[model samples]
Target: MTERVTLITGASAGIGTELARVFASNGHRVALAARRADRLATLADEITAGGGAAPIVIACDLEQPDAGDKIAAALAAEGVEVEFVVNNAGFGLFGHAIKLDRDEQLGMLAVNIRALTDLSLRFSDHLIRHRGGILNVGSIASFLPGPGMAVYYASKAYVLSFSEALRGELAPHGVRVTALCPGPVPSEFQARAGFLPGVDSLVLNVSPADVALAGYRGLMANKRAVLPGVGIKIVPFLLRFFPRGFVLSVVGRYQLRKR
Candidate 1:
């Protein structure tokens, strides 16, 4: 029999690392994928030492067009089939759309949008056969229009919509899909985005470990979307009361302040 495994991308650090640990502790054999081979190796060792099955570490940049195919091939080579997929590999840049480097923004889309969609749909047969699940990491930005970080916010919006639609399509097949939307997570993400957290971030921030646990629980419960904190859970609800223009203005000012 082929071994069933959970495939988690962006497993090198932050919420992705925590998600891997949580899944492994719950008895899921994991496949860790990230650009950082050393980080992945360390995480693999930690999981094994903690009595979890050793993880298969695939170190490849998701920016490549064939990243999904590579991940599939790696798993096939090991005789493992995916029972769960965590599309947690993504990044953002904090700047006005016109001001940011064009190539960098497009690269973000390659990983955040294209690669995520590829992996989510690539193993549909395996997911159906195993009655599996998918957990996609979106952001609070998914619900709002961002003026400064336009492309990044839009990419997460795609994640939310795509995950929901995919969930409906797969529900009858006993496959659960959940979008994990967090707000202001303190991680390498802020650094890479060139963002310095301000008052808003402090108000909304949740620890990466807590976010991962919440995402795990939410996915198991078959929730359509998991917002990890009380602050985050209120965001969409509050968005309902505000006009789109007003919300856009607010986000625009916030991003401008960060810049």
Candidate 2:
């Protein structure tokens, strides 16, 4: 059988790194893109040494305006079409919106919203042309409006809406689009976001490897929305019955309150 190619963003560590491993083990050629070239190189080397095909590593900040186009161009140069797409690059800011730096918010939007949308739109076209698949990693935060993390939650909400709507639009072409909405996955997320200083570990968390496995299964099943972790799965459903204002309030308090 011909090798299938997958393109994953934020592929250096956390969920991205684990996702790359799972996809490679399942026999898909991967294109791993991240800002941390050193980490990506190490991972690529390990994949090769472990007898899996080495993925193309593109060092992209994604906050840079041209990152998405660069990723597309690199893939074109390789002459290997991407059959699977994973848009998993994102970050969160821990402070109140008013207290956060303006540029910091912009940077957050750049990676969390702009880059993900660019890749989804760009790669969905590529997938449509090839009749393949797309997997977008959104957060369970999408179900509510977060106060301290307002922008981040809204960005993921956009991801959830955009992916589900696109799935309906792309189904006719044999293209499958799934959005994996995981909650509080134990990852570089809190540390990188600088939330480790204030947040309690008691809040729900899951392993990145577990998220990757759920993502792989969700994409294969063509699930519209994949919310792994039973506790996390209950969240989105609970949000539906409650008032939006109420959910937002809870998110704000939970996110901002230091235990």
Candidate 3:
């Protein structure tokens, strides 16, 4: 019989790395994917040492158009079928949309949007056969208008919406889909986005390990969405109390201050 494994992207660090550890600890053989081969190898070694199944490491940059195909091929070569998918690979830029490098923003979309959608859909047959699940990493930014990080926020919005719709469609097939929306966690994301966390981040931040455990539990319970921190859980509800224009202005000003 072919082995079954959980495929986690962005598994080299931050929330992604924590998710890998959480899933492995829970008895799922994992396949780790990221751009950093060295980091993935180190994580794989750690997982094996902890008594989890040795993880399959696929070093890949999700910005490539064929990234999904490449990942699928790698798994097929290993003779393992994907039983769960974690679309945790994503990044953002902090700037006015017009001021950011056009190509860079598009590359972000390629990874955050394109690769995510591709992987989520590509293994539908395997997921159905295994009665498995999907966990997508989104941000509380998914719920609001982000004037400063426009494209990144928009990409996360797509992730949330797509995950919800996919959950409904796959429910009858015994496949779970959950969007894990966290407020902010200290990670390389801030550095890459050129963002410096301020007071708001301090108030909303949740640790990556906590976020990962919440995500694993949420997915197992078949919840539609999981907001890790109490602060993050309240964001969507609070958004309902504000006018869109006012919210936009507030976010714009806050992001500007971070610059």
Candidate 4:
């Protein structure tokens, strides 16, 4: 019998790569998509060397307008129906919104928000038709308004909100939509966001392996949301009860103090 196929965005590194590992270990034939094809190739090689299934690598910049169409076409041609999707490709821009280039901020939004939304909808449709599942990678930052990283936080908030709503809509169709809200994991993210130099102590962060395993299990079980770490699991509940003003004040102080 042919193995199940799962398409994972951002599969070149970090959470994405770990997610691929989890899925492949569970007997899924994975399709890896990321800008770095070499990285994906290396990861696939490692998986196969370890006696796990090798993933098909599809390299594409998801920020590009044609990325979604391209990926969908490529998968179809390869005869790999997407049995599951993990939308994990995203980035952040730190510093004041005015100080950052407008183009960069918008580009981050394009990737983090637009790409995620497009992938979710496309995969949701496929899953609804095929009885698949989806896991959208959100962030703990989504639960609070980030002052220094305003656009990034808002984009994640959209992710958390959308995942919840999508879960409700797709549940009856035997399609599960899981929102993965992780607090922090050491990865390429901090360096890219220009926040690497300032960080002293890490927060209640979980390993990418832990995050991926928890998220994968939740997605497979059709859980509505998966906040991997204990800290993150408790945060959204607090954010819901706290008034917007209080939450903002707390978030603002936390961020500004880092600078």
Candidate 5:
């Protein structure tokens, strides 16, 4: 049997960190990857203290084009065979597309789109060979358009679409692909996305641990998508029935800068 290792990206904080904890607590050896090496080390120590095997820490900046290759190389160097991958590394920018810094917007695309795709494809052979699976962190934003956070919304849309398609393609091969669409969670995402304080209250807040658990369960079940909260679960149905323009308008208003 192929060795099973769960590789979690963006493991330094927030949902990614929580996901790592969940997997580790379940007795899964995880490889934690993020730009924050120090934070990864701390998490590794915590997991170890909890009696889980010491996690492999890899400091990676997924924004670089070659990040997927580097991660593969690093894992191979450690003799870790990834049986499960959590593509939980992504960020967003809040603003009109034209108003946001071009480089920053592109950087968001690089991390949120390019890196995820690259990694998903990069490990496909291994996953299929081992009957492993992938869990992609999407968002409620994936269900509809956001006029203000245009690029971010579109990126998540891509995530949802890609994950669904990949799920269909991989299922016959015994590989599962699950898209985790979570509503607002108490995480660093909003702050890093440039939301002003209190903006996160625009939606119900669930804990990162809850989201991670939902994702883990859904992935194991091989579900196509996992919507964590009640509010989030209603999103797809609402989007299907709502008028597109009306939905876009509401999102525009919601994303408006608050004083």
Candidate 6:
């Protein structure tokens, strides 16, 4: 019998890799997608050694316009029916929009916003039919404005908003949609985003495994939003009581402090 696979984007490392482990540990076959095929191959070997089925590795860059279509077609060719989808592949740029490379900022949008949306829509039909669901990886930055990292924060806001609306629409059809909002974690994100040295120690760094576990639980339980850390959970709640300008000012100062 063909195994129903859980497709996780950015599965080569960090939260995405941990998410794959979570699904596979619980007996779900996984399909790993990322630009790093070597890392995916290593992870697949580990999973198979631990007695889970070998994962299908699809190596492709999500920044391409037709990336989502390619992923869908690859799954079809392999006869792998994706029962779960985790849109965890995303990146951030840490700088003023005007000062940063416009193409790089736009590329972040391509992967974080456009790719996520396209993949979700492409797999929605299969999910609805198979009683499966989608888990989108958002960020606490989504709740407020970010000055230094404007585009990255705004992109995540779209993720959280879109996930919530989609959840409502899919609920009656037995398809679950969850948004996983995690704060700073010990991952490649900070490095890729160009955080200053020793900056991560300034704040609490949560583990990718913990975030993945929280996300998995929320996705299975059909929660609207999953905030992994307690400190992170209070952010969105408090933002509601403050004026928009005040909130923006606070967020901007925080971003400035990171520099």
Please give each candidate's TM-score.
0.99, 0.94, 0.99, 0.93, 0.96, 0.96
Off by over 4 Å in 3: none
Clashing pairs in 4: none
lDDT of 3 at 180: 96
> For candidate 1, lDDT tens digit of each residue in 23-112?
999999999999999999999999999999999999999999989989999999999999999999999998878888999999999999
C-alpha lDDT (0 to 100) for residue 182 of candidate 4: 87
- The local distance difference test score of model 1 is 0.95
lDDT, model 3, position 103: 100
For each candidate, the alpha-carbon lDDT, in order, equals 0.95, 0.85, 0.95, 0.85, 0.90, 0.90
Model 6 RMSD in Å is: 1.5
The digit string of per-residue lDDT tens for model 3 on 1-259 reads: 7799999999999999999999999999999999999999999999999999999999999999989988999999999999999999999999999999999999999999999999999999999999999999989989988999999999999999999999999999999999999988999999999988899788998999999999999999999999998877888998899999999999999999998
Please, what are the lDDT tens digits per residue for candidate 2 over residues 125-236? 6688778888989988777788888788888899899899989999999999999988777778887676753333344466899889999998998999888777787776
Off by over 4 Å in 5: 197-203, 257-259
Encode model 6's per-residue lDDT on 43-116: one tens digit a residue: 99999999998898899999999888889888999997878989999999898999999999999999999999
Clashes of 1: 0
* lDDT tens digits by residue: candidate 4, 1-259: 3345799999998999999999988888899999998999999998888787767888999989899998988887777677898899999888889899999999998889898888888766668778998889998887788888999999999999998998888889988889898887888888788775333225567899999999999988878888887766788787778899988887777777766
Runs with alpha carbons beyond 4 Å of true place in candidate 6: 197-204
lDDT of 6: 0.90
lDDT string, candidate 5, 149-178, tens digits? 899999999999999999999999999999
